[model samples]
Target: MSEPALNPLLVELRERIRLLEGGAARVRSALPFGVPKIDASLPGAGLAYGALHEVAGGGPGTIDGAAAALFAAGVAARTKGPIVWCMTRPDLFFPALAQAGLHPDRVYFVESDKEEDVLANAEEALAYGGLGAVVAELVRLPMVASRRLQLAAEKTGTMALVVRRWRRPTEASDYGQPTASTTRWRVSVLPSEELPVPCVGRPNWLLELMRVKAGECAEFIVGACDASGRIDLSTGPAHRQDQAGRSFVAG
Candidate 1:
């Protein structure tokens, strides 16, 4: 008889390699963002297989919570399943989300009172595996807690978005910036020219990709949101002008 199969440890290693290759293939096929530029900026052209992303703003009246929701919703809308939005505050404007490309019917909202509970619930949802994305709103994220959440997300290949609503700079408790996220972003509303129409006014925002783990940090200006909830690229004067409007002069 030939040598008995092999050590149990060797068998397990082979199986693990097979599973890892399978998972890598799946991740390569998944594209989380409909926006090409944004996708290019993110690792793997989308949210990584297992990672915590943080969204934070300066202070109250910033509407950073809404922006986070919209961003997650937009990604979820492009993904395979519905989105789970867990929040301590009830100010997530569904209309604004609809304006950001997420269908109201595809969103599942879970309201929680405590920040810890919100994080726990989000971890649970991310572990479930069927949801497209999970968003949690909290003020701070501890390293231990984030590690647990990250492990859960990795097991299920789900994306976790954490919204940090810090009112003051000093309130950031966990070391520098108070976040255990793999990537961090700061979003703020920017001034837009007034429009005379009765439709939803021109939407503009200053999106800052403040931190990235595997790539160079960069910033770009994204114009207003249109009816389809897509960012409009023709808002600037350069894009608005017709080809004939340009004056050609000999260099």
Candidate 2:
């Protein structure tokens, strides 16, 4: 049977409607982790762009906090263009960030005494567009503030990364509160890899995906960020929980 010819007017009309309604024209973009096991478990097969994500330390220890910061740095490093980092504290070690592939040259730091000011600067940076990412370090992220940040990121297609910190150990419980972030992650320090030499090896981390929008929770015991900001799937027998043995099944 011969197929009927399609209507050009109908096709154009549908396209116009889609754009007007912010449908296909505004499709969600993704940043893949480049690891099949991890990417497969996330929506869009990767981290969604134009959205807000939260990362925190698993414990109150300094090592845990540094791990969380490095994790966020690795994420931002993978992206292109300049970055805006707003923090209440001026304690960021640039040399450590360079090791995670995020160089100080590409970053513009905004140091403020108040957390609210830091968040406001982050929101403004996200809305400015043409940037790679905006990172904000704050102790608490309220639902309303998160929603505002989410909207700003969506408008400019900028990735918003929130690094949650706490002065008091008890305040860590505040992360359980609801927010508009697309995903929440916790990074905990793990023992370093064993080496033939009697010296230290590359770091390892327990990367936990606590909450994800439209996705289940999951965790991975993987090699820590390298100089290029990429993490490797553990090949050691002790870390055989990776794709070689068990695949990443979102829980």
User: What are the Cα lDDT values of the candidates?
Assistant: 0.61, 0.78
Model 2 stretches astray by more than 4 angstroms: 1-28, 60-64, 239-251
Clashing pairs in 2: none
Candidate that scores best on TM-score:
2
- How far is 147's C-alpha from truth in model 2 (Å)? 0.2
Looking at model 2, residue 154 earns an lDDT score of: 95
- Tens digits of per-residue lDDT for model 1, 160-193: 7777765555664432544457777755544453
What TM-score does each of the candidates earn? 0.71, 0.83
RMSD values, in order shown: 11.3, 12.7
